[model samples]
Target: MEAPRLTTKTFHLQHGTSVYELHLKRLEADRVQLRGTKISNPEGSKALDEVEAHVQQRGNEIVLKTANGPHRAIAVRTARGVWVSLGERTAFFEFARKDVDAVSTQPVKTEIHAPMTGKIVDVRVKPNQKVGLGDILVIMEAMKMEFKLEAPMEALIESVGCEKGQLVDLGQLLVQLKTLDNKKA
Candidate 1:
């Protein structure tokens, strides 16, 4: 019998002023590898680096590991959008329908939520805090691993629904942002 076939997708990222394109291939047994290319010619030559990784589904928490390190990601299904975690260093990603591939198994939203029931290890933002699109909002500790929650959009925080050291449920509201009043003064 032939091995099961999986899908592949592409993504683009901008760090500072440089842009990169990433090609991701999903294999059987939950294996994924990514290769990145710099869009701008001045950045560098073309090269691809492969990482050995596997994904484990444990209820709400999806743990992904590569040879370099391991990442704990959270997913929350809301009426608005899907929230996903990139890794510990980066904030969560809030993705809308257009920003994600139709066939990808990952969530679409950039907003990071608790992957499992855990205590808030640290609250990085305060109520009414103005944050950028990828700012870190909170850090949660579960099963001795740390997960960072990030903003889905660039806006002023309307309210912080959770506090430091507070125990949060699986789908609890940790932070809320008010839409920017773009009207001129």
Candidate 2:
């Protein structure tokens, strides 16, 4: 996790039922330290390992130092969490530490919205079709630029809301997806 400015803070990061306490401290500019411990270890259970890492920001890029090595990454402070990019992999972490407290608008979302004002050039998937990550589900064109919105995660296509030549506005619902858990519901 990273921010444009520096400060000392504590946070609770949660993904599913796992909650972790994250403490951030800056010893100096370009040197930020991290300490993490799980906050929900049950009695008589094996303890969750405590983790420590360092973050060094250089201009627009960041270097994450762990026991492994210094790895290059980009960390962007988002509305609800930090968006960290390590090469082709990216992850979003949710927290409301210190002055930033943005609740995630969707708890269990499966809908895909229009990323921008665009004309739907094609709708590729039908209901019940299974798609994996990075699979393109829709093709859009806006301002003469083409965009392929892909599956954010692996799921079954529940429905499609647009068709060829359909014009959609920003945030318009374009497709609905359902994972295995939702199917069991």
Output the number of the TM-score-best candidate.
Answer: 2
lDDT of 1 by residue, 93-185 (tens): 333233323223332343445667999999888877788877888899888989988887787776787889999989887887754654432
Lowest summed lDDT over 10 consecutive residues: which window, candidate 2? 98-107
Off by over 4 Å in 1: 1-113, 181-185
Show the lowest summed lDDT stretch of 10 residues, model 1.
94-103
**Collision pairs in model 2:** none
Model 2 misplaced regions, further than 4 Å: 1-108
lDDT of candidate 2 over 1-185, digit per residue (tens)? 55546577777665443455677766555666676555432321123444445776876578877787788998887677677789788776676343222222223568999999989998899999999988999999999999999998888999999998999999999999998566457
The candidate scoring highest on lDDT is 2
